[model samples]
Target chain A: MRQNRTAWFFLSPSLIILFIVGLVPFFYILYVGFFDWNAFSLQKGMHYAGLENYRRLVFDQPFINSLLLTFRFAVYAILVQLVIGYVLANLLATDFPGKWFFRVIHTIPLMVAPLAVGATWRLLTIPGFGPVPFYLDRWFDFEYSISANASQAFWTTVIMDVWHWTPFVTLTMLAGLTALPREPLEQALVDGANRLQVFWYVKVPLLRPIILSTVFIRLMDALRTVDEVWMLTGGGPAAATRYTGLYIWRIVFPKTDYGYGSAMSLLTLYFTILISWLLYTAIGQQRRGER
Target chain B: MKKLITLVVLLAVVSGFGLTANAQDDNWWATAAAPYAGVTLHGVSESTPPSNYAADVLAPQFEALTGIKVELEPTSWDQMYDKAIKDMEAGSGIYDFVYIEQDIVFSYLAQDYLVDLTQALVDHPELAAPDFNFDDFTTFIDDFKNAEGHVFGVPMEAFVKIYLYRTDLFGDPEIQAAFEAEYGYPLAPAATHQQHEDIAKFFTEYGEENDLDLWGTTVQAASGHSSSFYEFFESIAPTFGVYNWGINEENWKATVENGGQMNSDAAKEALAWWVSLLQYAPPESTASTWDEVAATFAAGRAAQGWVYGENTAWIASDPDRSQVVGQVGVAIPPLAEGVMEAAEAGTGYVGYYDGGAFGIPHSSKNIEATLLWLQFIGQPSVQPEWAAAGSRIVHDATFDDPLVVEMDAQTNGYYTLLQEQGYLFKGAPAHPFHAQVRSVVEPFIWQAIVGEITAAEALDQAAAAADEEMARLGYGQ
Candidate 1:
């Protein structure tokens, strides 16, 4: 009992902080989500809305569209990042001349602020003045205009996210690769297995947990991305890039519809939690089956 | 020696009058702002030319005259509205003054978000500057007034989105001859939609043949920005005889079947015409707001375009900012059939008369100080230089000021047009749900701009969405 009291005492501050910042807001949003409240409407204060916001959200085509778009964007971004990041990590694991320089250069994108990354890409892709279009037109006779083309705008945002975050994936994977036991890798080699076979059969199996963790983290982060995309295209070229986060932002900030935004936010949170559980459960089940 | 003596005496007499006027102005600030001397006023505004003048010039002048400090933050448009609205909603008393854009003032008043400037002055007459004459401001002030005539804001800047063309291109004998040969019309400022289209095509082809890095026109058609929505609904649709975003004020219906013209034949034609111009405009048009449109014109990449008047002064006279400084010309927008007649009869307007005003929020702790700062800026004595610097004329006296007259000449009669025909242009409607309705309606317009949908389909969807949204907001009901 004395030891339990001491542990409780030690955990009290962090618990309080979490309650204040996390639980309080979560509950507050949950409560507010039931009322139709517009922050800008002084005359029409909070009205008992019940599930009206959720009902409307079901038919909110823009929000639904944004969710689908966001899902596709996350799938593409995560898969690409994982593959490129894994390749780069393996390549960097070997010693080479100027390895430190290559590592630093590869990691620079992770250090850049998302806003700066968006802005730099904007300047780099702006037609007439931007060098991207100039070079593309000269080299391949291809016209590159993000503003004029929705497909181009959407892909550019994806490319921008990849550029900004692939380094993070690479670095994490590199750490995991460095920390590998090496016993299995050496054993496979001693058994006359080729390098590729050893890497695919032994090394990958050992690194699966780390890879799964990285994928889970990247998936969550990509789903909620807003700032960089906002800065780049503002979810435009016909909102082809209006992800779930930007859609919620439009509701909460510009429209000032607190109730609807809160409802949407809560729904998104539920979806995220559901998705994480499914992913975790599926991966865990796969590991268990293999065992 | 006799002539020099006479000139010196004349200079001294003029200097004395100025000194006496300065002394009187100083005395008013000293007396009116005495109580609020140590108080600092916090304000937030968009970083436009006029707002910059208020921050960089008038704030310091006010501080010098009255020991009160003014911390004015001029920032991006989105940030300005977001900051101001959030501060007002929270009632945190963080901002003493905020820029109430003409379009959003109705919403602010509906929310009771601002202090009634007229009533505030009436309640505390001591805060009103003696030189601040409300009557000196033009009728544009009517836009900021509630139904009870209680003024909520002091007008800072006012300008129309005028049609700008290249004088050098139009006057070029070779180009004019070539254009006439092709279009079979005397090349001048477009008086009709057909003429504008012809001019656009001619200039584009001409640029290509001559190997010049130029386009025919500039379009404010950013597929994602709100400026494109404003451009279509306010500037272009009005010229096509669709007014007030085609929503019937009485029933608040936006669909044509319900007596609104949002998706009417005229509005569809207008949208089609605007989208077609993209072929002749710079590729940047698809990503442009009013700011990029202005920059594109200033860079001389286009021969003609619709430009906001606030950018006219610098683009026409400041060589450092504009390559076509000496080549710019201003004209009224091309009108559709009966559009001019409708505008003249006060039933419609030609284009957007955009502006903003400084108002004290009800949540402000320093309303009295902020009021003095507003009155100080609203004084007619400061109107000419501010008007000259910002290309905005809010007061009648600014029209006749020598400095403004000189600027008018320099900008090819921009102020003259404003004085004579500003009534033809109108601000946004008194929609208390402006932002809400606009947010719902603009996406369809974006789809049209990006070729995701046709103009008719886009407007049809937009109109239906606007009607449903307004009803949901309890407006039409």
Candidate 2:
């Protein structure tokens, strides 16, 4: 009891800050979700909306569209990142000169701010004056603009997400690759397994745990992409890129309808929690199988 | 004898300090603000030229005179609204003064977030500055007032959106000959909507054939941004005779079923016309806001477009900022044959009267001090410099201010149009659910632009959504 009290006493400052910064606003949002409230209106005050907001959101087609878009974007972005990251990790796993320099270079995009990254991409993909389209036309003789078309806007954002975050996946996989036990691979080789077979059967299974954890982290981030899309297409080309996160932002700020926005956000939170639990269960099941 | 000499020296030093203090000509601000001296006032505004000038130039001058500090936070539009609204919503008084866009004042009033400046000025008449003539502010001030005619905010910047074209291109004899031959009319300032369309088509073809990196017009139709939606509803729609963007004033209805004209034939034609112009605009136009449009015109890419007058001084005359500085010309935006008459009858508007005001929030503890600051900024003496910096004039006297007169000449008489025809333009419709309505309509407009839906379909969906939103907000039940 004394140790528990001491532990809590030491944690009290962090607990207070965490409650203020993280938990309090979330709970406030949860509370606000239950009422019909406008963010800027105080005279009308909050009307006890009960489940109307939730019902409206659940039946909202645009809301459902945004959810599907976000899910697809996350899946696409994660898969692309994983493939690129795996290829780079494999290359780095082999002995090479100045390998650390290449690794540092790969990780540079991770250091810069996401907003800046988005801005850079916005400028680069500009149709007439920007270097990306300019070079594409001048060198490759291609006539295209990523922002002018809805599908291109969606795909361009996915590409941008892939570019900015693939480095993280690469580094995570690199760590896993370096920490892999060499005994299994050597034994497999002695057992007359080819490099491809050894990698597929031994290395991949050993790396599954790391791969799952890295993917889970990236899935969360990809599911909540707001800044890049805002700077790039602004959820544009006909609301084609209006992901769920951007939709929530539009509601909370532009619409200034806190009740509907909070309710929608609470649903998003539930989905996030659900995904986390599912991933954790999958990881637990894989671990048991490995054991 | 030594003690007596020291006393005499101390007396001389004290008197010298008093003389220096008297020489500081603060015009009584130092005296009035003496009590609040050292107290800091926080304000937030969007990062526009006028707001920046107020923050960088006027703020320091006021601070130096009054000994009170001003911390002005200039940020992006979305973040600025979020910060100001959140502060007012929480009643935390994070900002003593908030820059209120003309469109959002109704909602703010409905929320009771603003201090009643009429009462503040009356109660603290002694603190108001001499040159702060509330009456001299143009009709733009009406946008910042309540239905009871009580003023809530001090107008800072006000101007009409005007049609800007490339003067050099318009004057080129060879181009004129080609335009006449192609369109059977002499190339001149477009007076009708059809003429504007013809000019856009001519210049687009002209640029393509000549390969001069030019387009016909710059459209602020960035499908993803609120700016595009605003340009369509406020600047484009009314010009096509779709008044109030199809809101029924009598019952606040926005659906065709309720007698609203959002999906009317006229409005659908207007939307189709706007989307049709996209082919003539630069390819990036589908992803453009006012900022991009202005930049494109400044870079000599677009021949003509409806541009905000606040950009006139810099884009048309400031050589340091604009590449086609001397080539820019301004005229009243083209309207349908009857738009001007309808606008006069209070059924529509010819163009946008865009500006903003600074209002003290009710949550402010230093309302008195903030009022003094606002009045100081509102003084007629400060109008010219602010106008020169921002290309927007709120005071009547500013029309004749020497610097403004010079810019009026420099921009080929852009401000002349403002001084003469500013009355034709209108601000956003006064609605308490301004943000909510826009949120409903913007995406549909975007989809219309991108061909996912026809203009009629988009408006039909938008009208239904707006009606639902308004009803949900407890209005027009």
Candidate 3:
């Protein structure tokens, strides 16, 4: 009883904050999702129209487009980031000259604001003023403008996600690499295993937990990415890069359709929870297998 | 005991300092208005003031006049709207004065979020000049009053969309001769959608041959409100006779379909013409918003660009802002074939849309002070000052002022185009779901422009969606 009381006292502040900022608002948003609420109206009264917001979402073409785009972005971004991060982590674990410099360079993009990075890339991709298109035109003879093409916009967004966040995965895997039990690696090395075999057999297997955790984290971050895409193409040419976050923002701000926004947000929350559950299950399976 | 007393006293002093800092009212609004003396008025703007014209000018001037202090709270356009809506919804008095878009006033008014200014104007008659004729305001300004005939807001500025072109680029003899030979008319700013497309194609082909790397025109195709797509569409809609005439007399619902009266055969043809011009526009135009379009013109890549009247000052004042500042010329948009036929028969409507207005909130504590500020801002004495300082003013008398006329002439006769074209400017319907309708329509219009869907299909989908939304909101139906 004493231990429970002490624990509760220690957690009291966080619990209070969670209730006020998180739980209360979450429930209130759910309540709001039922009504036809416009954010700018003078009337505070909300009429109860149960399930209307959700029903509308089912019929909303744009909302569905945004969801599909988000999923596509997430799949492409996560797979690319994971592979690149793992390779880079393996490279960094070895003794190489200017390793610190390379690591610092890798980390720099992560430190820069995502939106600023997107804007900078946009400036660099402008037809004549930007050097990328100029160089591409000069060398490869391929005249391309990423801002104009929807496919190019999608790829650019993927590349931007990799550039900004692969460092996070690299750092996580690096820690995992450093923390691995040396005995197994030594035993494998002694048992006539080659360097490649040892790495593939021992290091990667042990680093699964860290890689899974990093993937989960990146998955959530990728789901919420709006600022970079917003600054770059703004889901444009025609609804090409509209993410879930941008959709919700349009609802809450421009459309002032908070009820629909909340419904969409609740749906987003459910998806996020499902993703988290899957990650947890995957991690648990990997851990149990290792045991 | 002595140490405990010392600690308590120190804590008290620290808390006192924090409280005092939060309570300080150093702005001009706090010092100027008699009723609001020692009270701070938070003023928010969508854009940062130009270096030559900062809030300090109005802050000090207002303070000296009214003894009230005004604190300037600057934010980006999107952020300002978000904050304004949140504050208004919560009934939080965080902002005493807000600069909002004209289209949004209906939604704000419907909510009773804005104060009625009729009584305030009557009570503060001294604020008005002997020549402070409300009649001087155009019908565009007068139409924004609430249904009860209460003036909720005063017109802050009037901006009409005009076509800006580069005289130097089009003045070349060879290019001019070729254009006239091909189009059977003098090479000039386009006067119709067909003319505009022909000119754009000609310029794009010629410019490419010359290695000039210039576009014939630029239009915004971004995904948000205030995207120039709407303005571009609006400029040609009247020419096509595509207009939201009014609500149905019996139904009281939005009129979008019914053989596309607003979304008519002519409008679709106009849209197709616009889409064809995209080939002449810079490839990046698909992602361009209003700011990007402005930048495209400023960069000297576009031979002609559609822009608002206020942007003329923006281009002229900053050398770094535009490459063809001295060389730019303005003209009213051209009439379409349908409009031309109507004009030949002496029956056509040539109208642009007004952009923004200013209003006091219903929760304002100093109505008289706000009214005074409104009258002062609208005065002929202050109108030219605001215009000269790079903000647009709505008064007709101000346009005739020597300084304003001289400035306009110096900046390539933008004022003349404004006065001629400004009178024809109308506003969109003030229904509550108007904003929602815009959101649904804008995206699909882009889809149509990009050929993801046909114009007719996009219009039908948007109309059906809008109708559903209006019905859901228990409006229009």
Candidate 4:
């Protein structure tokens, strides 16, 4: 009982800080979400909105479109990043000349700030001045205008995300691969399995947990992506890239509709939590099956 | 005893000379700001030329004269507004002075976010400087007044968006001959919508045939940005004889069926005309804001464009910033029939008279110090140099200043046009729900710009959305 009291005393400061900084604001926002509020309106203050904000959310086409777009973007980005990262991880597993240099270069994009990456890509893709458009026009006569083409803008954002995060995925998979026991792979090779078969059957299964966790992390991070995409296209080309994060920002900041923004943000938080729980459950179940 | 008396006499004579020196000139700031000396005034403004001048030039001068340090943070337009509004809403007193843009001032006033300068002067006469006279400012200052004619902000800068064209292209004999032969009209500044279209087409083809890196015009048509909405409504729609975002002020409805012109035939026509200009604009036009449009014009990539007047002086005179220096010409925007008449009769306007004013927020901790800073910047003495540097003239006296007259000559009579014809232009309407209505309406405009919807369809949807949003905001029931 004394030891337990000592532990509680030690943890009290963090618990109090968390309550003040984190939980207090969270609960306050949750409370505010049920009211019609504009911070600028001194007279009106916060009216009792009941479930009106939530009801309006169901009919908010922009919000719906943004949520759908973010999901689509996350799925596409994760699938692409996983494939590319796994391939890079596999290639880096082999002993090669100047491997460290290539690895360092590959990891450079990961180290760059998202805003800087977005800015660099913007400089590279600007219509007349940017090298991407200049070279594309010179070589293939293809008109590469992200601002004009919605598909191009969306895909470019995906590509930028891939560039930014593929390194992280690769490193995670590589760590998993290096830690795998050599016995199963050696036995599989001796049992008449080809290299492709060995990789598909042995290496992939061993890396499954790492892959799932990587995907889970990347998925959550991608859903909340705003800075890079904002700097790149500002969720433009007719809201082609207006993901849920950017949409909530538009509501909260520019529109100053705090109630709707809070409600939508809470909905987004719930969605992310649900997704993470599903992934966590799947990983746990897989571990149990392995045992 | 004799030496001590001589020393006292000498000291008295020196003190008398010092007093006379102090009383020689009108140093009102030193006296007015004496009580507030040593107080640091925090301000936030957009990083425009005028605001930069306030921070870089005027702040130091004000500090030197009054011993009150001014810390002005110049930032991007959106960020500035966000920070200022957030600070005021929180009642944090973070910003002693905030840039109240013409469009957003009504919202600030509605929220009681700013300290009333006129009232402050009335309450504390000691804080009012002799050099600071509100009547010295042009009618643009009227936009910053409350319902009772009490001033809220000191007008820092005000300029209209004007039509800018390349004089070289318009004056070249070969190009003029070709344009006449192709379009059956002499090449000059466009005075009508059809003429503007013809000029755009002619210049585009002219560039294509000559293999020149040039387009016909510049368009602020970013498919997902508020700048596009502003361009269409404030600059383009007015030329089509639509005003006040086409919402009927009486009913606060934006649809034609509801007696609002937001979705009227004229506005649709205006949108169609603006969107159609995409082909003639530089490829980057689709991604452009007012900044990029000015850049396009400065690079001599566009033959003619509706450019904000704040960029006029630099684009026409500063060789380092503009390739079209000495070749840029300023003119009125091409208008539809009877639009000019309506503008002249004071019932409507041509293009946006864009500007902002510095106001002490209600939450300011150092209101008196900020008021002194505001009065210091508002004096007619500071207007000439500022106008010369920024191409923004807010005071009536600034128009006749020698420095501005020279700059007017350099910018091809831009100041002359602004002084003579500025009254025809107007700022945004006095709507407290300005941003709320814009947020709802701009997406449809963006959709139209990106070809997801037709002009008619976009405005139809936009008008309906605007009316719905306005009603939700309790503007009209």
After best superposition, candidate 1 residue B62: deviation in angstroms? Answer: 1.9
- At residue B67, what lDDT does model 1 achieve? 93
Q: Which one wins by DockQ: 2 or 4? A: 4
Query: Per lDDT, what order, best first?
Result: 4, 1, 2, 3
Comparing to the true complex, what docking class would candidate 2 get? medium
lDDT of 2 at B441: 87
DockQ (C-alpha based) per candidate is: 0.64, 0.51, 0.26, 0.61
User: Candidate 3's residue-wise lDDT over B264-286, tens digit each?
Assistant: 56666666666667788976676
Candidate 1, residues A1-291, lDDT tens digits: the string is 999999999999999999999999999999989998886443387888899999999998889989889989998988899899999998999999999999999899988988898889988988677899889998999999887787888889889999899998998899999999878888989999998898789888878877888888888998899989988888888888899999998898888898999999999888888887877886797689769
Q: Which of candidates 1 and 4 reaches a greater DockQ?
A: 1
Q: Which regions of candidate 4 fall more than 4 Å away from where they truly are?
A: A40-43, B1-27
lDDT of 2 by residue, B1-477 (tens): 999999999988999887765554365787778888988999999888789999999999899889888899989887889899989988998899999998889888888889988888888877876667789899899888888888999998888888999999999999999999988999998888788889999999988888778899889887777888889888988898876768897888988789787888888888988988988898778777776788888889899998877888889777887999888899878888799898778767799999999999989878888988898889887899899889989999899999999988889998888988787889988888888888888889988887888888988898898888778777778
Which of the two, 1 or 4, has more TM-score? Answer: 1
- Candidate 2: residue B331 lDDT (0-100): 87
For all candidates, the clash counts are 0, 0, 23, 0
TM per prediction: 0.96, 0.95, 0.88, 0.96
- Lowest-sum lDDT 10-residue window in model 3 chain A: A38-47
**Model 4 docking category:** medium
Question: Which DockQ-derived CAPRI band holds candidate 1?
Answer: medium
> What's the CA RMSD for each of the models?
2.1, 6.1, 10.9, 4.9
Highest DockQ model number = 1
Order of candidates by TM-score, top first?
1, 4, 2, 3
Pick by TM-score: 2 or 3, better one: 2
lDDT of every predicted structure (CA atoms): 0.91, 0.87, 0.70, 0.91
